[model samples]
Target: AQSVAQPEDQVNVAEGNPLTVKCTYSVSGNPYLFWYVQYPNRGLQFLLKYITGDNLVKGSYGFEAEFNKSQTSFHLKKPSALVSDSALYFCAVRDRADYKLSFGAGTTVTVRA
Candidate 1:
């Protein structure tokens, strides 16, 4: 089984400041981690993914994540946040041998101007 956790329920940051959404996972085998953001009434948008290759993975919306095997963490980070970046963020993970993807409860981010 695979599961993901976003310890924080909400993250508040000022515009132009760095933003981070923490995530940790547990899996039976190797894990495939992913980050998604959802705006109000919108579907989840892919932010980043860590399947293989380098430890650092970059994806849409100027977001990046680092895959830490030892700690089983893949926290999302943005160098600077924009007011428009406010949304609900999700951390998901799937065991390499499993077909199901388990997602966290989600963390809401509010970027204030």
Candidate 2:
């Protein structure tokens, strides 16, 4: 079984500052981790993924994530924050055997101008 945990319910960041959203996962074998973002009244958009190779993977919108095998974590990061970056972020872990992604509860980010 695979599961994802996003410890924070909400994250608050100011414009121009670096931001991070923590995530952890559990899976049988090598985990296929992913990050997604959802805007108000819209579907979830794929942000990034860690299917294989490098532990650090870059994604859309100046976002990146570090895959830690030991800690079983994949934390999301951004160099600079923007007010428009505020959205609902999610961490998902794909079931290796099934190829279905199981998402976390989601973390809401509010970037103040």
Candidate 3:
């Protein structure tokens, strides 16, 4: 089975500090990893994706993620947090065969000033 797990239900960070939201995944074959963010009452926007090759992948809104095959993890990171960055985050993985993405429960990021 293919699935993703976001260990944190919510991550609280002070503005201007770095932030991280943990995620782990399980898949039968090679996984296509993705990160998406959702603002209130809005659709999810793609942050980044780890298709292959690169272990460190950068994406929109100053966000990046490290793909660790051994640990089965892809944790989202940002050097500086902003209040505007507060939102819901989701980790997703596409199955090698079906190419359908299965998403994690989601983690809410709260950046306080």
Give one digit per residue, the lDDT tens place, for model 2 in 54-84: 9999999999999999999999999999999
lDDT of 3 by residue, 47-89 (tens): 9999899899999989999999999999999999999999999
Off by over 4 Å in 2: none
Q: Which 10 consecutive residues of model 1 have the lowest summed lDDT?
A: 44-53
lDDT of 1 by residue, 1-113 (tens): 77899999999999999999999999989988999999999999888899899999999979999899999999999999999999999999999888899999999999999
**What lDDT does model 3 reach?**
0.96
Alpha-carbon runs more than 4 Å astray in model 3: none
Clash count per candidate:
0, 0, 0
Query: Which pairs clash in the backbone of model 3?
Result: none
Question: In candidate 2, how many Å is residue 103 off?
Answer: 0.6
Better of 2 and 3 by TM-score: 3
